[model samples]
Target: MVSLIRSALLLAAVASVALVGQASAECETIYVRREVRDLADEEWRVFVEAVQKVMKTEKPQEADGQAMTIYDDLVKQHLDYQDKCHGTPIFLPWHRAFLKTFELELQKAVPGVVAPYWHWGFDSQAPHHSEVLSHKYYGGAGQGEQSCVPDTPFKDYKPTYTADGMPKCICRQYDDNGNRIAPFSPIEELASIVENSPDFDDFSSRIEGNPHGLVHNGIGYGFSSMSSPSDPIFFAHHAFVDMLWAKFQERE
Candidate 1:
C-alpha cells in the first residue's frame, strides 16, 4: 500500500473538508468532465482564468520554506512520492484520487469547473499542429535560452521548482519540427488496449505504458520531473487518461 501519508500535509486544514465534505454519501451528483476542444468559449475562459488564479494562490502552509502556490505544492507531492505511485498497479487508483484533489483545489477559483481532457489522438497525425500547442491554449514548444515557453499565459510564471531546480520556467522541449512529437498512439490502438484486457492488472499495465507514455513524451518535457504539476496541463492530460479507465469500466 502506497502511503497516503505522502500527501497528508497538502493544505490539510483547507482541503480536508473539500476532500471529504463534498462526497456524495448516496452518490447522487454526477459531474461532467469536458474535452478541451468541446468547451464553449466562455467555459474555456472560465477554466483558463481559474487555472491562472490558482497558480497565484498561496498554499496554507509553506512546504519548502518558500510559500508556493497551490499548484506547485501539488507538484511537490508527486516529486516526494512518485516512486510509490508510478509503474505499479497503484498508479491507476493513486492518480484517480490525485486528480480529484486537483479538481477540488481548482474549485477555489471556479467552483463548478473540473479538469478538461486533451483528445490528443485527434492531433496524432501532426501534433505540432495542435491548437493546444498554440497560444490559444498552453502554447507551443519552448524557444531561446532554457526553452522557456513564452506564449502561454504561464509565460511569465516562475514556478518555484523543477527537476533541474533552476529553469524558473516551464520548459517544453518540443523540437516542433514535425518530428519532435511523434504521432500519438492511434486512438483505436488506445481503445483496443483498454478493451482487450481481461482484468484489472492487464488493463492497468497496458494503458499505463503506451498511450500514457505518448502523452508525456510527446509534449511534456517540462513535466517529466518533481514539479510537473507546475504545469496546469498535467491534470488535463491525466483527466483524459482517467476517462479511458472509466470507459473500460463501462465496457466491462
Candidate 2:
C-alpha cells in the first residue's frame, strides 16, 4: 500500500510539472516584423519631407488643442493609414510598425535620413535622479545608473529569436495552477510585464491611477500626459508598452 501511495504521488508531481511548463509557454512576447528595412532611397526623401511638414505645424499646446490636432491629423494619421494592421492587444505591433513606417517614410521623403525612436531605455542611464513612472521620489542612483528595477522583461532579458527572425520573451499571463494562459489581459498583466522587463523602468514603484499616463519626474522626465506632444518619449514609450500587449495576444 505504501509503495502504491508513493507511486501515485510521483505521478501527480510529474503532472503538475508538466502543467506548469505548459502554462509558461502559453504567454510569450511576440515580435513585430522588422520590415522597416524595406524603405528605398527615393522613398526616404518623401518621408523626411513629411517630417518637415509635421514639425512645422506640431506646436505644443500645454495639454491639448491644436498641437494634438495637427499631430493626429498630419503625423499619426499618415502612419496608421500605412500599417494595415489592427486588434486590441496588438497595440505594440501596430505602433512599432507605425514608428518604423514613419521612419521609413521620413527617409523616403528626405533621402539618406535616419530618425531616432525616443528610447526610455536611455533613462536607465540618464543622469536623472528619480523613478520616472513611480509616484515615489526615487530616480537614478545619482551615479547615472538605474536605481529601480525594470518591469519589462525585454528591457533586461533578451529572447532568442525564432527561425523566422522574431524576438520572443516570457509573457505575463498565468493560469490557475500558476501556468501562463495566452490571450493575456493587457489591463491585468501590464504591471507584471513591466516589472519583469529589464532596463525599462527607472521608477521602482509600479504605475498607479492610469497605466497610460505620462512620466512625472521619476527619471527626470518620464512619461507625460499625451494630450499634447511636448514630451519626446511619449509616442515611443507607449509603442513599447503596446508591443508587450501584442505578444500577450499570441499563445502556444
Candidate 3:
C-alpha cells in the first residue's frame, strides 16, 4: 500500500511537469527564413496549414455573438492595446510581447515563411498611388489635394513607422513632423460633449466611448479608407514591433 501511494504521487508530479512544459510551448520567439517569402503556391498553402495548427494551439477567445476565432480575438486585443498604449510609450513593449506570440506561432507552423517589410518602392511611383487610390481610401485623397495618403493601402490611411523600423500600414496626412494636416474631431457633432468631457483626451478617446474598439469602425483600414485587409507586409511590421516590445520589457 505504501509503495503504491508513493508511485501515485510520483506519477502526479511527472504529469504536472509535463503540463507545465506543454503550457510553455504555447508560443515562443522563433525566426522564419527570408526564403519563405518566395514560397510557391502549394508550399505556401502548407505554410498556411502550419500557421493554422499553431493558431489552434493558441485557442484565442471569441467575441460574443460574433464569428471571430481565437486568432482573430488575439489580433483585436493587441490592436486595441496598441491604440491605448502607443502614445504612452511604456506600454509599447507590452503590446509588442503580445504580438510576438502570434508571430512565432505562425512561423513555427509554417516553416520558411518569410516575413516581409513594407515595400514603399511601390509608393514613390505616381502610377502606384493612382492604382491604390482607385481601390477606395485613396479616392478621398483627391489628386493633388493637400490630404494625407498613407504609404500602405489600408483605409483611414494613417502613415506611421514602428520604433523597430517597420512602417505601419496607417497613413495620415501630416507634415514631416507628425502633425495632422486635417485633425479628426469626433466633437463636430457633439461640441458640448467634447468641450466637457475631461475624462476623454487623445486620438483614441472616441474608442473609450466606443463599445467595440476597431470593430465598430471596422478593423484594419476603414471602408471609406482602404477597402480590404492589411497587405502581407503588415504581419512583418507587427512582428518587428512585437520583438521590440519583448526587448523593452527585459529592461523594465
Candidate 4:
C-alpha cells in the first residue's frame, strides 16, 4: 500500500510540472514603447520608412466624405475630435488610445515597429539646435515667406488637409523675431508641475498649459494649428507627454 501511494504522488507532481510548463509557453510577452532617443540609427530608419508607407498609402474606404491616405485620415480624425479630446478629463486617455492605434498601424506597415516618445525635456534647453531638427532627421528650420519647410524627407510631401481647409506642403517655422522660438519646458519644470498637482484635473491642466503648449507653439506655423498632427514629429512629441502622465500615475 505504501509503494502504491508513492507512485500516485510522483505522477501528480509530474503532471503539475507539465501544466506549468505549458502555461508558461502559452503566455505572450508584452512590449513597452521606448524613448525616441533610445532608438538606434537602423531602428529610426525602419520607423521613418513605416511612416512614409502609411503617408503614401490611400485608405480603401471613404469614411468622412473623401478618399484619403491613412495619414490624412489620422489628421482628419484629430481635427474632428479636437474639442472632445483636448483640455478635458478625457485628454490623457484619448491620446493614449490614439497613440496605441497609430503604433499598431505603423506595425502593420513595418513588422515589429513601435512608436517612440520624444523626451522633450532633454531638448528643452536648445530645441532648435536639437539633433532631431537636423536635415537628416525631421529637417532644419523653415525658409522663405510663409515659413515653408525645406530640405527634409517631408519637404515636398503635401498633406490632404490643412487648418485653412486646403491642401498644402508641410510647414514649420522655428524662428520668432529673428531668433529661434523659446526652448521647450525642461524635464525639471515638468517634474515640478506633476509633483505639485493634487488631482487628475490639475495634472492635465498644468501639462497642457506648459510643455505641451510650448512645444507646439515653438515649432510654429503648421505645428501651431489645430491640424498639428500633420507633422510627423507630433506623434513623438505626444508620446512623451503620455509618458509624463504615466510617470505621474506611478507617483500617485
Best by TM-score: 1
Instruction: Tell me the TM-score of model 2.
Output: 0.31
TM-score of each: 0.85, 0.31, 0.35, 0.84
Looking at model 2, residue 50 earns an lDDT score of 51
Task: Estimate, for each residue in 147-252, the C-alpha lDDT of model 1 and write its tens digit.
Answer: 7777887776778667764488877776345236777778888779778888767887888887787767767567656566777778878888888877876664
Residue 37 error, candidate 1, Å: 0.5
Q: Residue 245 deviation, candidate 4, in Å? A: 0.4
What is candidate 4's lDDT per residue for 1-252, written digit by digit as tens? 133224434533442343343343543656677887688889888998999998988888665568788888788777877887787666776667677667878988998898888787888988887777777677766777666677667665578878984338778876565237687887789999778878767888899887899988888778888788888888888999988887776664
Clashing pairs in 1: none
lDDT of each: 0.74, 0.33, 0.34, 0.76
**Residues 156-214 of candidate 3: C-alpha lDDT, one tens digit per residue:** 32222122322343322222222211212122322333334443132124322331122
Please identify which of the two predictions, 3 or 4, would achieve the higher lDDT against the true structure. Answer: 4
| Residues 37-150, model 2: lDDT tens digits | 244545434433555444444435545443442333423342333223222222233344445444444444454444433223333333232133222211112111221123
RMSD of 3: 16.2
* Over 4 Å off, model 1: 1-25, 62-64, 175-179
Weakest ten-residue segment in model 4 by summed lDDT: 1-10
User: Could you tell which candidate, 2 or 4, scores higher by TM-score?
Assistant: 4
Report model 3's TM-score to 2 decimal places.
0.35
Deviation (Å) of 41 in candidate 1: 1.2
